[model samples]
Target: MSTHVPFNALRPGVDAADVRAAIDRVIASGWFVLGPEVEAFEAEFAAASQVPYAVGVGTGTDAITLILRALDIGPGDEVITPPLSAAYSALAVMMAGARPVFADIDPARLTLDPHATEAAITSRTKAILPVHLYGQAADMRAFEGIAARHNLALIEDAAQAQLATFDGRAVGSIGIAGATSFYPTKNLGALGDGGAVITRDAQLAARIKRLRNGGQTSRYHHQEAGANSRLDELQAAILRARLPYLADWTKRRRAIAGRYRSASVPPSLSVPREFDAGHVYHLFPVLTSCREAFQAHCLVQGVETLIHYPVPIPRQPALAATNPAMCPVGDRVCAEIVSLPMYPALSDDQVSTVMGAFSSFVPPTR
Candidate 1:
């Protein structure tokens, strides 16, 4: 048994030559860093997201951090967020100098529970950052109503969701501001690290632009102390080159997900949900109490499995130092979750092989 069916193989698509061509063109032009490539990517991304403006930045983390900074949310401010996601969500809040107040998730969807979110709000609450975990839109309609009542800023953590939508509205454009990652594993990934901020509000957009480029509207005239987090021109060009084919790749991902659902999954395993057409299936995570054992089984069966995250942000040494009681739900889910192979290039044969591995194991009837 060969390990060809590994966890995730990079599927750069047949059009990567175009990405290389775009990169070569940029190199030939001498102008690099935040230049035309970045400008064009920003404009194209805004159009794709149906937003007024889009700001490309250094990384997914910077996308979130810069958005919070632009909103002036720091120090005494507290942001409500889901407890069942990458600690990066919490890290972004801490980096912005705010407290990350965690809300429990809807176990079925593995996204923020709107009721829990509203209950968690306090006087210090300035924003609600709901992660569109596993490429499915969070219940934004519920969150929006709550945000309106409290006058809180709604920032979407859309790192996993590129084409994902909410009621026909694109994920990044739904909230006040949305942050997305172009990490190699995302639905619409870039060759290397990259990210963007999308928003409909022009004022918020202007601030994010300044935040990404050191708060200087003009050349070298600094206003506020901002972090250096601009999206690289080369990466932007690569992303732009790939953007044209996003729809096709996304459709393939959905098709693969359908196969997984129709096929035989482990009886004890809980599959991810299909919410409208918005779910992009970034990482098809499954819930299992015996995650360690399941991973071991996959290893023996020549399939690779990974935990999206094993530790919640609050429990991490760095985060625990500040807030010991950050998020209990996030902590528990991180312990029990496992991400299966879920890229567009994953073949039907590979799906069958993984399913066979699951069928081979069965728990004793208790």
Candidate 2:
């Protein structure tokens, strides 16, 4: 029988003993939602990001929407963001009743091109929502300059970049406010879907706290009509348990990425470059002109691979008024990027197996 190495090896209990214990602890507590667990997790997460406050929300999408809504970015407001990203960040803009203006990415980092973001600005542009795609922070220094010049809110979508830093500061802490997800696949994932809006701004944090709780300033007294999107105590507990382990886990992930970078491969394939304190390698993206054949070749070697995004943002039908001409880099990058197996749990043998898969790869013959 062939040994099969999957794209993501994330199994519960065996992989996270503390997570299992936390779940049991929460279950016994009887108070499952918006309790001490959530409060503590929020505090701990805020500390991890070097921020003063973190408001827990139902999901990453809600975190984004709440942050946007708290800032009063709505109706006629335009938020500039990278076109090549998970649809939820852009959709959050829509949820907040704002228009999402697609901007081309820097081909090198695959984050928003600072020039493209600045060029997209108009009187209608009220904010810049930059996604730290694939566990890497964007060039915040450039973005800060742009935001200051235009007086636009700089919000970070840090769903994939838990504990990832840029320059000397944590990614989520640099912007006006940062939204992050704890989806099962994320580096700092909870047991299920969870998210938080972290910020140094106390007023923004207060507004978000109210926004997530049906706009209740107090118990049962509604202030403004808001969505119910509180993060549950159980998930928060799981996150708290896992939080202490993240730094070390990231180190292992870095080691794997280093190996992948040093490995010799076919001329057609190109691995991502390491950025100092910027990338946490959430998904190790490798590009190839011949993506389909490369994926097929890996499959034959009993190694699995997947694409982070197979379709460009403009190509997605759910989004309205999407134009591929507006984001040429994203259009081309989507066609070629493939995610190799990259989770902290991956053994050295598995890493070697993937490297071996690369050595045996053959291009498809016409």
Candidate 3:
């Protein structure tokens, strides 16, 4: 009988007891929103991210939008972003009332190409938003130079990359501000929906905190029109319980990815090169021209596979009015990419099963 390999397992295994304890503690406190648990999680997350401040929000999308709102980037402004990421990255810009300009991705790194981003910038461009796709860091060094030259904010969409570093520097801290999600599938995920903004700017952090809470500097005081997007205490507590185990989980993910990398694959499939050693291996995706057949083959072997994205963000029907520009590289990548099982919960037998499945695949000749 062939061994079955799941794409990911969300049920808490090693941290089950701690997770239960956290939920009980939150229930006992009877403080459900913007309370001590959220406050403490913010500080702890800030330290982990190597940033001075972190503001918890209702979701990752809100975190990105709030960061833009705090920077006063909206309405007539334009933000350059990669087309290959989850549509939420661009939708977050739209939520801020700013238009998101689609930029091509670096074919090798599969990230927002610095050159393409710089080219996309116009006089109205207020920011360059880059998604750290598949847990790999974008070219932050080049992006820093581009932002410096254009006087634009460099915001990192680090939803897939938690505790990932770029050249010894932490990802979220390298940019003006970084946004992350804890949507159960993430590396440092919470029990439910959660997100945060990390930054070194104290004023920006404070502004985001106020902005996330219905624009209130104090109770019943609406200084400006702000969205209600505070990270609740229960989710914060859950995240806190899971946070300490993140480093080890990241290491396990990296080890699994390394095994995948070292495994012999057929000529039809190729793995993307690891651009940085600090990658936390959020999702292990391999490229193949024969996506449908490859997926079928894996499924037969009881190995579940998924596509990271099948369409470029700009191509989504929701963004049709943005007059979205064509991203040739992104379109090609979307057609070819597929994600294999990559989670810390995967056992040694599961890993070997996945490896054997990949090794045995032989693409049908045209």
Candidate 4:
């Protein structure tokens, strides 16, 4: 019988007992929304980020939107973001009533190129939203310098980067405000949809808190226009349960990435770029010349793979009115990229099995 390796192997290494225990405790408390569990998770998360405060929200989208809104970024303002990223990054800007200006990424690191960011700046530019794509930092120190000179808000989209660093500094803690997701598949995922905004600014944190909770600092007092986006108690408890393991989980992912880098393989299939610092490897994406053929082969061999994003945000039907242009590198990378199975509990045998399938296809000459 042939063994099958599923695409992500969702929520692997989770102890059912741990989840049950957290659930039981939450049920007993009867405080569901923005209660003890949420508070505890926020505190724990803030500490993890090396920041002063973190506010849990409904989703990563809301986390970015709320932080932008709190910073008073609105219709007349423009926010610079990467051209190649999850649509949510640009969508968050629109949701905040701001214009999202796209800057091309550094092809090697797959992150916002600082020079492109500087060039994209205009009179209307109010913030720079640099996404830490694929569990690696987007040169925050460089962005910080640019933002400081331009007096722009430095917002970080660290959805994929949990405990990943640049020059040994945390992504979330470096920016003015950083947003993260706890979607089912994230390195620090919750049971369901959840997210958080982290910042060192006490006042900004307070403003974001109000913006997420119907614009009220107190109960039933509508202070400003806001939206309903709170992290549920159950999700918070689950996140708290997983919090302790995040660092170790990241280390394991790095080890797996190292394995892939050192392994002898076909040169036709491009591996991820080498980095000087740590990368959590949320998805160990590989680039292939014949992606469709590769995917077909993997499927026939009882292995599953997925594309992180097939279409760029600009090409989406919803953004058609926006007239977003074609990004050549972004389009090329999207067409060629495929994520392999990666998770904390993934076994060495599984890794070998997956790699063995690719070994059949030899490297083609230039």
lDDT tens digits by residue: candidate 3, 1-366: 878898889999999999999999999999999999999999999999999999999999999999999999999999999999889999999999999999999999999999999889899999999999999999999999999999999999999999999998998999899999999999999888999999999999999999999999899999999999988999999999999999999999999998998899888888999999999999999999999999999999999999989999999999999898989999999999999999999998899989988888898988
lDDT of 4 by residue, 1-366 (tens): 446778875653655678778989999988899898999999999999888999999999999999999988989899998877789998999999888887777878878889888998999999999999888888888899999999999999999987877888878888888999999999998889999999999999999888888998688999999999999999999888888888888888888777767766676687868574667788888888788888887777767899977887777787676656466777778888888888888788777767776666553343
In model 4, what are the clashing residue pairs, if there are any?
none
Evaluation by TM-score, superior candidate among 2 and 3: 3
The runs of at least 3 residues in candidate 2 whose Cα sits more than 4 Å from the true structure, single-residue gaps closed, are 13-15, 321-325
Candidate 2 vs candidate 4: the lDDT winner is 2
Model 4 residue runs over 4 Å out of place are: 362-366
Off by over 4 Å in 1: 324-328, 364-366
- Tell me the TM-score of model 2: 0.97
Candidate 2, 1-366: lDDT as tens digits: 446789986676344778888989999999997899999999999999899999999999999999988988988888888878898988898899888888899999899999999989989999999999998889899999999999999999999998888987898899899999999999988768899999999999998888899999899999998889999999999888888888888998889988988789787888766665657889988999899999998898878999878887756787756332368899888999998899888888889888888766767767
Candidate 1 structure quality by residue, lDDT tens digits, 309-350 = 787656678766566355566666788898878888878888
The RMSD (Cα, Å) of candidate 4 is 1.9
lDDT measured at residue 270 in model 3 versus the true structure, 0 to 100: 89
